[model samples]
Target: MSPKSLCFTVLVAVFSVLASRVVINPTPQVLKYVVDFGLTISSSPSIVAMFIPFDFDDLRRHHKNPDKGKPVSVCEDFPPNFPPPETNTTLTLCVDRNGCCNFTTVQAAVDAVPNLSIKRTVIWINSGIYYEKVIVPKTKPNITFQGQGYTSTAIAWNDTALSANGTFFSGSVQVFSTNFIAKNISFMNVAPIPHPGDVGAQAVAIRIAGDQAAFWGCGFFGAQDTLHDDRGRHYFKDCYIQGSIDFIFGNGKSLYEGCQLLSMANPVAPGSKSINGAVTAHGRASADENSGFAFVNCSVGGTGRIWLGRAWRPFSRVVFALTSMTDIIAPEGWNDFNDPTRDQSIFYGEYNCTGAGANMSGRAAYVQRLNDTQASVFLNTSYIDGDQWLLSYDT
Candidate 1:
């Protein structure tokens, strides 16, 4: 055979072997690169090949996105350089006759907090009646407003629904856009009333609109509309909430653990009118399926006669689990909100509830006694299963 023909034969043989093999290489950056070929010998020999290149930068960007999976950790610790915890030292914020804290008001201290501080910052409020409306915005979390005492460190305001040109649903201490911790503080509404029939006159002592807000060992005092536990998920432990009419009414999902529900008598009553509006008008519309008002190991006591609860609107859902009720509770346990048709849509239940008021013999047939498994859902703060956001609370 000629030398050129021999070279051609050798090249064909080498190509035939290469077609059946695959090659993989790893770059110094730990990316995998692969090359593969498949051979067909029909007519003249032909080969099909493919190449795959891994891009580390594209993968890194995807992992860093918050909506995607958890962010990649560049450092050993997940969150590098997290802020240190705040010291428990007390910072006295005195609101004097001119409403200033060391020449600055209480609002000034709240606004000055560094964002996302892990430390527990306590605002030690001195003994004086503060008249300004206070708001704890969401930017400043883990803040504790500690009062000298419930009475001594009182925050008093007279912003009624009528005077403020708002509804009882509007809060006096409007806790919006903030996760707050309040303890040993008294939130009072000093609103005067002319008559009991004045339906529009409403005063909210503390309206909590922030999610995950907590109140510990605090007293909320007002006559008509008080302690408006408004929208969002909130926890109130070891607190006293007092009001006369449908006071504790709101759309928020709340867990009142070991709290006191007090009822102030209609100031105009001359010992003649025996019946007062319901103590709790849960007002949780059905549109809010996960929204509810839960009372766990709470006590319901009042000066005048009051029903344990009433459906403030159609399709309200409320549950009182393991709560102690005083004789002030009406025999019926729940009111119809003056609409008999609401009986079909209202969801009012009691689970392991004890006391003279829990007697179901006289309770409306619509009122149910939830089974153990059913009541467990309401006991915990899992508005949605597996989320466990409520567990983040300092119960």
Candidate 2:
């Protein structure tokens, strides 16, 4: 008999006996599937089958209640007994425009806290879109912004570099405090998407200049400069960020773990040479600055042809370790932004990255394929000084 017929017979006989025990094991971990040949028998196999491990528990839970959103975990930045009932020790302020909370606007709720207070304060925002520019000044420490969920709670605004505020100051939410934490929230910039013809459209969703800050389950959306990790040491986990040009640009020492970096298409212009934009523009100006961006095990994909990064400053530094990139990434993974001199200074590298886009064969000459030892430096939390703060919060 033919190989295809033999395999089909074998599968039928195997499944027929296994089906008898289905009542005992309702959900099996193994998933079996068959593949058909597309080419000639010599070039391609007539029958190929494989078994994959499927997560039945998660699948069942999701099917049970698809509408229910994931619950927000308690802030790791604060202690278990943090925010005590005492006004001096703790405060929980709610902001709901529909009269379900203390204040209607987010700023009002934030302003209610005492400046330079040592106590922990949690601002719980209800599900709604608040179109306002929110700022957490340097004075406020140990403050947490808790939202209903990323899709349910959003702080959005429209401001571009061409606006009166300028690129550096045009942020929907700007945080300059220390020991701050945000969870299940979204920071959005409603500025128009950038086009090749556009001149300077750098809008920021969130400008985080805070030290020892952590964001979890958050979303940042914009076109250019979506997230400005400007100055400080920070950590981001399970977050989604989408943009077109130099989206996640900054000088902060940051560790992005298990996050998503999505690319959007750039509008076509009369004389545009490239249709896609660069994902990062790290600004580590000098070698002395202890700042860089490390993305570990992150998912990088989306529309448009894009580069992993471009040198925003002379000593720009960035790394991607064990990340999964899509075909959208350009073969020349890193760009010098037409500045040949920057090619000598950028510390761009990748380690054990997988995917068609992660291939280093066609990458720029300056881009380094890190070895096991070199990759270890950027893969851990220590890259962002997280050893000092992250452990404390996590405990």
Candidate 3:
């Protein structure tokens, strides 16, 4: 069979099984809607179908059936008799707001896990918007937040630096525990983007102050201080991060692989002509800090003129290798954080990067155009000691 037909057949088979467990507003019209939608699923077939949100009215108008109405029970799809094994070392707790599974809130589920447990615990968050400030404290470890999909599951908040707590404490989702993994989730800070006279508008979508943490197929969205990769050895792969000012800043010895860094339009400050933003502000205070930002096989694009990075601390280090940059990047890329003295210690470099902004002619004199020998050091998993913690989730 053709690939499209094969995909449809598989989806039909999968959803047919799911339909047995789920009553999809059960009516002949609804049943016909299933058949029509199932055939349309060929384009983006996902075998993992569950309680996917569907518009009942939209379906009913398109097809007619004589079956009477009844209250739909989402729990039927997840029977208690088939509860997850109790002794299963690799536990997965489902978080459904409508009391369909184990817990209703994400924090409640996180609180249930034992601290410092050796076994990996997976918190499977359903497709919905969770408005909460989540934190995985230092005492907890080996935890994974698995979302349905990047666009489908989101955690959002509106905290800012001006809050009773400072910017350092203003993360919508802060992870301090080691060996944490977040997949297919979007972390958002809904606070207004900083503007002129906007005091303490450093809203952070997510903060990683943990070691051996990894993010895959995730998204971070905000305007200023979008992602605080605060401190640790971390890895971000196939993720999307969008912001305007110092969006991807931190002191973490981390690697961003195949990720997208989007720069929003400039937020003009008072009396400023053509205001712009910087993508990163690495804060490596000393040479012994063992922290830097590595962008490997990543892409930088979006609106507004911006600098690739600025040194938040004297010894800050950052490298962009085999990445793509758009003309949005400032010709003189790396900034010295308005401190000329930082020019002497900061290590900002790029290697084999292609795009309109990759021209070395106008790049800052201090920014290195690394040769193969130097580029090798920052282009692999070794940059974040991934050999030790990233083996299990190598995708």
Candidate 4:
């Protein structure tokens, strides 16, 4: 183990001892919508998770089914599962709405971090809805947004494509710096939901243009273009993403494991669904772009007849492995965006997936028939070079 890992292991042992002595009694009101964890390190979900991610089933055991409901006003404070900095001199910023911490707004706390600092700066956000558009600039790298819980803490805005000047800038939470980490927080674009064929209604909950970004137990909410996984390598584990048309779109080389992809597509009669929505719209312009989306052991469910993904760009690439899909998916598993030429280049495939929607009888022709060897390349964190920056965890 690296020195950092050795220190974290020691800290975990010490913290476990201290945690066993405490008693937790959350208020009744806060327990109803859990559908999850107190989250990381009291106020550092992203930090604790990266260093000590548990088993997938352990992560899934407490989660409520996405179709059942979302989290309401529920969150509980706790001791750090693993606090960083053996010394009290380490850098950490606290954001609380009532001014109980270093700052009130998330952006202000982000601005407080030193630019070009090699050490990671964590911003602990208290449980509350922050109505603001936050950005992590390129100059400041290694910033982490650790929240109380996915259901209790949120950053919200209502910028539509036209309102924000462009769809790319409409995200409520935008990350442009490298090595960004967010855990247990929900990013929401609360603009009005749009019709299936509507235009200018693209509202992005989060736009991650940063390299080496990782999100754990997070939430993303919107109607269209919900998550702009813009560019770079990202890992999202056990996240809840809700949206309609092209809900999860972008060019990022991302791996989404143990995630719940809840589709918010309208519930219409099967035959009446003419202008329907799609779950993903990967925009890989060239075969050599080195960007695509790989979803492993995820769950896809919700209303509307949705396409697994469409060839948003000519050379778009995507894969779903060991995932469970509902009948909400269109019979034709994928679309070529009405471009016959794209059918020659796009790579859309599924392997070992289950559920009615996973049936391949009506799938598009261009889908790659992936074998075990080919599927292994995109099966784990290795696809995104995660070992370099991410904490080494058994999961």
What TM-score would each prediction reach against the true structure? 0.68, 0.76, 0.80, 0.78
**Per-residue alpha-carbon lDDT of candidate 2 for residues 263-365, written as tens digits (9 for 90 to 100):** 7754344344464788899999998998999999898887678889999899999999999998778888989877999888889999999998898999899
Query: What is candidate 4's local distance difference test score?
Result: 0.77
lDDT, candidate 4, 1-395, per-residue tens:
65334434443443343334433233211111101112233332222110111122212323334466653221122234434442343467888765555788999988988888777687888766677789999988988888877755778777889779999999999999998888888887766677776678789999999999999988887889999999999999988888889999999999999888877666877566454789999999997899999999998887788898999999999999999999888777889999999998999989999999898888777877678998999999999998887743221
Model 3 ranges off by over 4 Å: 1-70, 78-83, 86-88, 267-275
Q: Residue 217 in candidate 2 has what lDDT?
A: 80
After TM-score superposition, the amount by which residue 129's alpha carbon in candidate 4 deviates from its true location, in angstroms, is 0.4
lDDT of candidate 4 at residue 154, scale 0 to 100: 76
**Which one wins on lDDT?**
4
Candidate 2 Cα errors over 4 Å, as ranges: 1-84, 87-89, 266-275, 391-395
Tell me the lDDT of model 3 at 227: 96
Clashing residue pairs found in predicted model 2: none
lDDT (Cα, tens digit) per residue for candidate 3, span 58-173:
22332333365554455544446533665646767788765778887788888888888887788888765576788888887988898867655777776789872788789989
Single out the weakest 10-residue window by summed lDDT for candidate 4. 28-37
Each candidate's clash count: 6, 0, 0, 1
Q: What is each predicted model's overall lDDT from 0 to 1?
A: 0.63, 0.75, 0.76, 0.77
What digit string (tens of lDDT, one per residue) describes model 1 on residues 1-395? 64324433433343334323423232111111122233333432222111112122322443476576667643222222322233464233333333323423457667766676655565656544455677777777756776644533556565667668886444557776545778767786655531356756777778877777777777777666677767777878777777677778777778888877776553224434356756677766676456778888887775667777788878887889998887667777888887999999988989998887777788888998899998988885464232544333342
